[model samples]
Target: MFGPWWKLGVDTTLLAFEAQAVIGLRLAKLAAGGSAAQVEAQRMVSEKVLAAGEAAMQIATGASTGAVVAGYRRKVLANHRRLSRAPKGAAKP
Candidate 1:
């Protein structure tokens, strides 16, 4: 009866968990401490904000929820890839 509703909650929780892990890793990288790292962190924030704004605009223009979500999902996966990779010649975490 409540399967769809419960599934919605479960899916949302999983997405949050995944995003949190990526965020934590990103913070750990930033914590290594350097001007370049800080700058890169700021840039990442700006990129996310821009993407969110774009998504919002798509919704305002009557785009389907799935389309907006798919776009954001792509961005999140891309960020995860970028954040999880070790920079060239950098020490392992």
Candidate 2:
């Protein structure tokens, strides 16, 4: 439950840090290169890395949201079950 949520956050943060490191390395390579082709390749690699990071973040966010929703749904269902088990004074219209 809450454990999974915390794990997800930690996992996502680690992924993001890795992605940033990759992008930084690519940038450094691009800066150290003398040829235009090398620079262009590095730029492409950086773009791909950033795109992957964005996708990963999106997936993590979606998972977190789904977990929260599911937890809320479970709580609501439990409350409903409790209410149903109580004695009612009047019948529903």
Candidate 3:
């Protein structure tokens, strides 16, 4: 397993895995006009990936102070909340 500092987006393979996790069985959902759900799912992936990558980068660069980690976490969580509020009947994208 990748360490906490792993940046999932930078690696094509990791991103492909993340996409598969969210979209593999959800094609039908999209076709059913489930864009909101898809968007929400993508948001979760983005939050998780970004947190891991940013945290790792911070520690790697000796910048993972308490405030830095807390701020990064807050940002990720806030983004998730925003993404999750999308309209359920939103158009498919």
Expressed as tens digits, the lDDT of each residue in 19-70 for candidate 3 is 4544533454455556655785686578778778877888888874554546
Best by lDDT: 1
- Candidate 1 lDDT at 86 equals 75
**Model 2 agreement with the true structure over 8-90: per-residue lDDT tens digits:** 67655655565455456546646766684385576566755765575567567774554544443443344344434424565
What's the alpha carbon RMSD for model 1?
A: 3.0
10 residues in a row with least lDDT, candidate 2: 78-87
TM-score to native of every candidate shown: 0.73, 0.40, 0.44
Ranking by TM-score: 1, 3, 2
| Residue range with the least summed lDDT across 10 consecutive positions in model 1 | 4-13
Error of 1 at 37 (Å): 2.0
Off by over 4 Å in 2: 35-93
Please give the TM-score that candidate 3 achieves against the real structure: 0.44
What's the distance in Å from true for residue 55, model 1?
Answer: 1.2
How big is the positional error of residue 20 in model 1, measured in Å on the Cα after superposition? 0.8
Q: Sort every candidate by lDDT, greatest first.
A: 1, 3, 2
Estimate the overall C-alpha local distance difference test score of candidate 1. Answer: 0.78
